[model samples]
Target: MSIQNFLSNLDPRLQRMVLKNEQLEEEGLHTEAQKENLIPVIAKVTNIGKFQKITGVQKVTEITTAPDRSGQIVTAHIAANALPTVNKSPVVIQLQGAQPVKPLLKDTAREINLPSPQESSGNGGEGVIVGIVDHGCDFTYSSFRNTDGSTRLLALGIQEMMNDRTTSFQVYNSQQINKALGKPDPYKELQYPVDKYTHGTHVTDIAAGNGRNNKASGVATKADIIFVEPAYWDIPRGNLGNFGDSINFIEAVKFIFDQAGNRPCVVNISLGTNGGPHDGTTLVEQAFDGFVTDKPGRAIVIAASNSYADNIHTSGVVAQNGHIDLHWSIPTNDFTLNEVEIWYEGSDTFQIEVIDPQETTVCRVGLGELYHDGQIFASQEKSALNGDNVAMILCDVDREDMSTGKWTIRIHGSNVNNGKFHAWIERDNHTIGIQSIFAASRDNNYTIGSVSCGHKSIVVGSYDAKNLNTPISYFSSAGPTRDGRHKPEISAPGHGVLAAASLTGNGVTGMSGTSMAAPTVAGVVALILSEAKALGVNLDIDQIRTILERTARHNPPSQQGWDSRYGHGRVDAHAAVAAVRAMAEGRQPLPSAVTQEEKEALVRR
Candidate 1:
């Protein structure tokens, strides 16, 4: 009998809710008996109310055929009232298994309409090392090499050395090092050699592999990928409760950071600890935050863990009893705020770092005075063109302010011959204290400073492509550090992306996640660093974050600005390149200290 008949037989009240139409045909109903017997049978026998209770579905709307012709299918458009009140309802239906789709590769790869990379005319990110901490990488894969004797992908086997009893580096045979060196295969015992599962390889390819031989490309096509294997073969017995120890992870990080390589490099950590970092129990923080540092051109880019599962920090923060919390607050008891004092010891005399904010850590250095209205003002002391420190002030721009005037931040360059001022912070002044107010406004980027909490690291989040349809990957992590600061200093593409993978010979694999997202960013960073070096612009990680955040593409304000989900909306590679060019030509202005509003506004755009 049809599902409807079954449901009607089970409960007559369900008859009106279940209907038959093209949906059944779409489900591939090949025979009349199957069609006639399924829906009514399902409706008659199925407990609609019980099904709704279990699935958070309102009244059953329709009983359709399965996408595949295997069986009858049912779908429901849930009601607002049917949302899970106590806990999230797990999806009960098992989806049909699908084969991986091979990504299409263009004959000539093109970057999304962002301006061509500044240093991309020649090799960019060449020789820079990026670390991928995941399952494993297949060094023997062919896509890792190029035809002209240049290595497109170089694999540093981290898993092979996992269980070696020797503390000495020589434990790895000469062959393994040869593989790392891109030399002919010389190794004997190759356990966990090439990444058997495709996750790590796909991620590595996006960061480094050259788009040669009809392969999908990566953003940093010239970088070297160092794979840090976290576990042995998937312990089929692995369970959520038994998260594995990541000693190899820590060791891999230490090895990369300690490498005395020549090229200025950046490390990308796409994986995130499942629990919230603020819970104070995740070993990830102990390994990452305790070690990653900001020293000149070297840095690390970490993806905020995606909020797929319920989070006490986010979900719990929602106000109950009609007390909706539109904002987060800093605890008054925290001494980090009251102890704020400007300490300057760096050689750069033109800029001072804003170290503390109402106990929240939103650290960034700008050329200006700490002003009221929670902003940093550029110094008008010198009538320096564009670089003058007066354009960084942020205001809680109400409708009146928008109607009356628009605010702007300035950038200054050393090449300006005339003493013209470029102010980046100039808005009406308000109360000046070391605290941030949790208000919903376009200029509230500074209010949630989680991503920037670890001011010393390069924190990134993800956004949809220009086409913007599709759930933001549930795997991409969000930010607003436990301390109430904006995090993921910026956002990038983390979705159903196509990139090169380690298949046997010049092969490719397809996958998606921030794991792919972060390497694309690291490559961009490498390009920026190259431009800065060429242009003689001495920049720091904070400067890069502020520049990227300020110049990124802006989405509508209906979506919160600098929210944990998408910090600084989507990255505008073109805008970033333009900013770099303008800075190099002395056409751009230097930014003043940023106010909460100004910073938020920059990030929102």
Candidate 2:
């Protein structure tokens, strides 16, 4: 029988036990389910015909009524009608259409397998410094407490140098002069107040907030943090831009690294402009690559931009001229056959192609015949150019007005009713693919970080370290770089991750983003470095990336080779630590640093 008919015949008591008063005998659900009149009903046991002949039960478990017609009910197996069910003795309650329960971490008695006791002293990032290139950190956070329950960050670098306090943390006038002179300010005071977004504090918590007092802590909980405020947002003015001009960023990156010295440090930038390398070359790259000395363990991490332009907004334009393809910003994914498309404008035809970032080619084409329909015709074929160049495809269309003039480009991952590709028509090109970072969902560009001034260093990605089946967040940006180089290098736990936040503030907020994911890898890096110190083996940034990538748990679901989405798959801190430990003991092959110089050179260039 159909569900409606079957429910209508069931006894009222049976219905209450199974369907939770889903449908009424007299008036039906809609008539009786008035908002205020609706009441939740607990399930009770009932009897059926021959089904009861097998098992015996006194009563059925209670089910709550839907609130205000906002619920549905169904039934399946319950305790036997003949068998006695003891109270609170793990009764097997069965219901139809119940969502499958995801096993909790606790349910699976998998030991929290950290490395050997000495390897996991929680001092992976000991002595190293990380700059929270964000708003500002709260020096008074309770997470900075020591074993004796005293706060360790009595004075932070930013708070000390910026504030008027007389402790050693104070930023003296000489330091202020150095900062003003474009030199490294060892005593630069914490400039922004604690309440400004609390971004720096939260980020600091992820990178190095010592896990104190059951507080949310980061991977490298004991590392030092330098707060750098690079973004200033004015809600009234709608100004959400970087602190200084591009030139200022060049100076800032260099200064941070200069102060880092011999210890390994990572400068984390969680911000970006709205375009590609051509439209915007992360201003810091100019200085970071130019002047900073290549210390053994120092590196930088920059956030991929969060800007996205659909039909309503477009930020980066992609076009081609002749054999050469030009892009204003990095496309969402590497140029595959999947991304290329050809269009017909009346009798003419034109094709769109995305080229490699490193190629230097020029386009030899211009605006042409206009077409009324979406199709554009191929007017002619020009000679192959030497470098990347983008030009408007010649098309036939009538338009004198540039303002509000629209064009369309077919796209994927949109809401197309049929199994057809969607198209976006906007005034400018959409930001192609900043959303493809390792663990970043499409919502915000939080977790992505560039290695240095250059875009080449490992931009870490996210994975559900605890749950293997969950898909990588839809927001995680994917990349092969614009040049098709495997990026993000690898992944880590970025979902529902526990980490520190401002102490004086809410102290903790459940956060999920690539931002949360990157630190897991960063923490592992700290562990590797820490182990290296003990073994007296010097390692470089490239070596660290290689070790992690080689030891990364291979995910078969990821695209062929290393995919843009998952990269090398989720990182295993324990596995990575083990690999590094084995290498230190000469039991396994050490990861090669072939990409190290290239990575550093990319930053410098």
Cα TM-score per model: 0.51, 0.51
Best by lDDT: 1
lDDT per residue (tens digit) for residues 254-315 in model 2: 44555566766666554433222221122233224322225466555543221221211122
How many angstroms is residue 245 displaced in model 1 relative to the true structure, after the best TM-score fit? Answer: 3.0
Compute the lDDT of residue 272 as modeled in candidate 2: 37
By TM-score, the best candidate is 2
Q: Per model, how many backbone clashes are there?
A: 86, 65
Per-residue lDDT for 95 in model 1? 11
- List lDDT for all candidates, in order: 0.40, 0.37
lDDT of 1 by residue, 344-442 (tens): 112222332222233332333343223322122111111111112221222222233121221212122323232222111111112232232322222
Off-target runs (Cα >4 Å) in candidate 2 are: 1-117, 120-122, 145-191, 231-247, 278-283, 286-293, 302-387, 390-456, 465-468, 503-506, 556-561, 590-605
